[model samples]
Target: MTTRILIAGGGYVGLYTALRLQRRLRRGEAEVTVVNPENYMVYRPLLPEVASGTLEPRHAVVPLRAVLRGSRFIAGRLTGIDTERKVASVAPTAGPWLELDYDELVIGLGATSKLAPVPGLAETGIGFNSLAEAAHLRDHVLRQLEIASATTDTELRKRALTFVFVGGGYTGVEAIAELQDMAIDVLAGYPELDAGEMRWVLVEAMDRILTTVSRELADRAMTELTGRGIDIRLGTQLESVEEGELRLSDGSKFFADTLVWVAGTRPQTVVGELGLPVDGRGRLVVDQAMRVEGHPGIWAAGDCAGVPDPETGRVSPPTAQHAVRQAEQLGDNLVATLRGEWPRPFRYRSRGEFVTLGKNKAVGEAFGREFDGALAWTLRRGYYATQIPTWNRTIRVLGDWLVGMPFGHDVVNFGSREEPRGAFEEAAGRSRVG
Candidate 1:
């Protein structure tokens, strides 16, 4: 008998789960297939460096073809899953809806950028979640310095040099820190532009930044950021961003050309389309075994699924750490189910939280102890290197770091911003043509 398995989303959970599934399942008993919009599993932990031009954009992405040796990999975005029919509709690049049938399904579609509207945000603001965004940010930041140096107009120059970061989680903090470091180095090339003139603001609605870490560390982070002249705004909100106006909750107004929205993410909408049992937050509800409740032969994990934490009695924090662990155990449970054995519950405590700040600076808490500055930075890199699933990636990343230590950033603009714009841009061009 052939048991066909299909896994969705090629992120941390999807890739790792499939890797484990292929290893654990009997040779002829089951055939595993994984589907994802991206053909590669992006090592998202290093995206900050990519945005800052510290790491090549491609360095963080591991191609699925090379990684998933045994399992069949499909490049497609999931449209819907009919649990009753046990069929999945996939929409690949420019093709009819591809149908895939699965005896068992793993929902790991991962989270998406929660782009709640703030007026003019889409056009003017950049996001920090994707490879494209990382590259664009690097180019934009460098270009800003060049523009500022050549331009005599003070307002235009200020607008160009100013950078706004909207969220203050690990992504926002690390991004601001790394980019700030990079900008300082890049500014050395332009004699006219003082690095001090460039403004970096970290905007967060919460009372403090890096709330995931301990309060002591969060306060230290706040002091460090402020000391570096990065304005830390708390209990505030962005009302809108139109033209030059950036309205805020504290009756404050600011103007800048750059706005980086790290506001956070939500699960993919395909989960709702699947008509599976979902939580209020649009995440799939899974048991301790990582199996979807009331659904036969179906399982879900990662940020897209609500896996409860036994210690807290709440859903597990949707971090990369938890996602990988869930996938690992989920694989083991599925293998046990295939063998007609009782599956074990997914139970693990979060080891700690860590955030990187530029080259040799970081802040973290591990095993109830706090580590900051150089030591934390080393631990951060060490932990991720170990966490990365493949030896090939581990070696490549380590080599890159070794070279980057003495030699500074390898910054280059590959020019990805030339995608054709709409009628408005065409109209402007037409007016010029006349």
Candidate 2:
């Protein structure tokens, strides 16, 4: 009998695992089915560029159907799992719940922003995790510029021009830097708005930013950002956000129209509901081979799984590189188990880490060497271009970069795109009255 493999989530792990299985498995070897909320996988590292209009929103995502040709794809969410019966419950986009039986299951249902109990934050602050959020941020920032330029009220203008980011990690730093760069570049078009009036503040509870990188690199990044007029508030916490007012632990009070929250992330809520062995951080417990402990046919990886790192003897840090490597090992292990062969343990050393500051600006360490500025930026782009899966996407990404260097950032605001049906609704109302 052919084995049934079900992979949940279409992020890095899900996509890569399915790709590996499709390539390795022979005809009638095993049936693979993938379930995910979105039909496309967002290239997360390029999200900063997407927010800055350096790359188009569509170009930053890989269409799942286009890439996962061999496996069955279901556009839905994995709601629950029955480990005893080996059945998974899926809720499709426009249908009833589905019960899928699988001989082996892979859980890669990524993470979501971890929100603190800061007052009014849930209602007021926005996250920078998804593609939609990145695109929305671009439009929102442009709208703020328009508001600042047209308004004569001093306080309102100050609020509109002020942008606050809470977090000092990779996402927080990269996002603020890219968006700030874009705003400065487009300031010439807003003749009424002065660049000096814009305030970009990055608040971090920790003493340093980018703890994953070295202190020298972090300090270098800090210097680069501060040189660009961004306020780097170290060891500061966001106390509260009330009615557009921001209170910090450092006894500072401010009112800013835009507040971006990128503090940290936790696994998807459904992961907890799966009744599996998870660590204290709520990540599924998996051995070095990416297999869930006590559950023979169940496997997990990526941000949602506490996959042990052989080199460090600790759970692997949730990063794109680690996730990709883990997925490959998981796929290979699954194949080995089916063939009655012993699976090898997943082992990988850190090649490097790159943090993009802005266009042609980055800091990275590769091959035991530290690099910064344009060289690091180019290396980062080249690495991601090759890792983005399909050649079609690779060409489009490179083309965007080539076009962007000469033409500069696109400043057009398409905030209306969010409400594409508004015009139709208004027309329908008018027709009814007529």
> Best-fitting candidate, measured by lDDT?
2
Q: Write the per-residue lDDT of candidate 2 for residues 1-434, one digit (tens) a residue.
A: 99999999999999999999988998999999999989999989999999999998899999999999999999999999889999999999888999999999999999999999999999999899999999999999999999999999999999999999999999999999999999998988989988899999999999999876789888989999999999999999999999999999999999998999999999999899999999999999988788899999999999999988888888887889988998898899989988989887888877899999989999888898988899999999999999999999999999999889876677799999999999999999999999
Off by over 4 Å in 2: 429-434
Q: What is the lDDT of residue 214 in candidate 2?
A: 80
Model 1: pairs clashing at backbone N, Cα or C within 3 Å: none
- Residue-by-residue lDDT tens digits, candidate 1, 37-155: 88898888889988877666677888898888888988888898777889999998667889999988988988877876788888778888888888888888887777888999988
Q: What is the lDDT for 235 in model 1?
A: 88
RMSD of 1: 3.4
Instruction: Flag clash pairs in model 2.
Output: none
Q: Could you tell me every candidate's TM-score relative to the true structure?
A: 0.94, 0.98
Q: Residue 163 error for model 1, in Å?
A: 0.6
Instruction: Enumerate clash totals for all models, in the order shown.
Output: 0, 0
